[model samples]
Target: MTREVRLTPVNEQNLEPLLSVAVAEAEPDEVMPPVDAPAGWSQARRDAFREFHRSHFGGLAGPTGNLMYAIEQDGDVVGMIRLGRTDEPGTLETGMWLGKSTRGQGIGLIALRLVLAEAIAAGARRVVADTRPENLPAVNLLRRSGAVLAQDGTTVRAEIRLGVSEDVDLLDAG
Candidate 1:
């Protein structure tokens, strides 16, 4: 049986596994995904990614700009989930990436649920996501999680309404 999947707030200390997953899955398998490699695999490229993540992860872009979480199983990192604010107020978008080995097994669905919960707590009334039309895993996850799909061009965008409220209990509230 598979173990229960859990989420840890992403931080500098436990982010290595997340970066590793991106590199390990950069190459497409028998099935191609719309997303590409995390960027280049060179050392310079890796350095750039590290620097960029540090900024975004550090919240330098503001609280709502990039909120990320680490997907964990048995205390080990397996993937990452991120919720980001769009240009529109009170709206957010989500994205996720899992290790090739960790795909399926209901991990993605759970991660998305957790992230969307956090989004709701953060005052997002709506969240949207998009993937290639053939990315059935994502399409299905969104549907199963109650996101409405809007297909256009070669991609489909999933939108979930979290409901607007003036008294949302923000997750970061101290």
Candidate 2:
């Protein structure tokens, strides 16, 4: 089945649905690092989620700049991708999250390729991603995406050089 994965801008119309994914998480909601809430979430949760995303979408840019995109599959939102430039020239850093139900379905790989395509088009020489070292799924995702992995104490960094090319299968192989 074709996922028809594409990157779209996040706006008010789609923000709630994205948050709903977090709220739907069966865990107790918190405004902290893994911010989450419930269906009938309080204003506090909304504010926190908005604040965190605001930075990614509109607030002060990180490092050089930042770009956020909504990950859509067959016209439905499935995840998010954020790209922020690092201090180094021609390099950009990216992070992404997919709805629990969307994991392991090859959507993440598609999103990674899309993000890389955008970054390279914007003149990025390399793309880097940092995830927790213990997050095996994330680590494996990056590795399978052909990124070089380096683990520091707290963060595992994966990098892809955009100026180079390898025969990668965009939809089937990661």
Model 1 weakest 10-residue run by lDDT: 27-36
| lDDT of candidate model 2 versus the reference | 0.72
> Tens-digit lDDT track for model 2 on 1-174?
766999975667778777776566422232224545544466766677766665656511443266777788998877788777676666778888887788889888899999998877666778899888887888988998889999888999899888633343222221
Per-residue CA lDDT of model 1 for 1-174, tens digit only, reads 867778777788876776776667644232122333453475655555565556567441465477677788777788777777677666788888788887888889888888877787677788899888898888999999999999999989999988668456343243
What's the lDDT for all of these models?
0.73, 0.72
TM-score of 1: 0.80
- Looking at model 2, residue 103 earns an lDDT score of 82
**TM-score of each candidate?**
0.80, 0.79
List RMSD in Å for every model shown: 4.5, 6.9
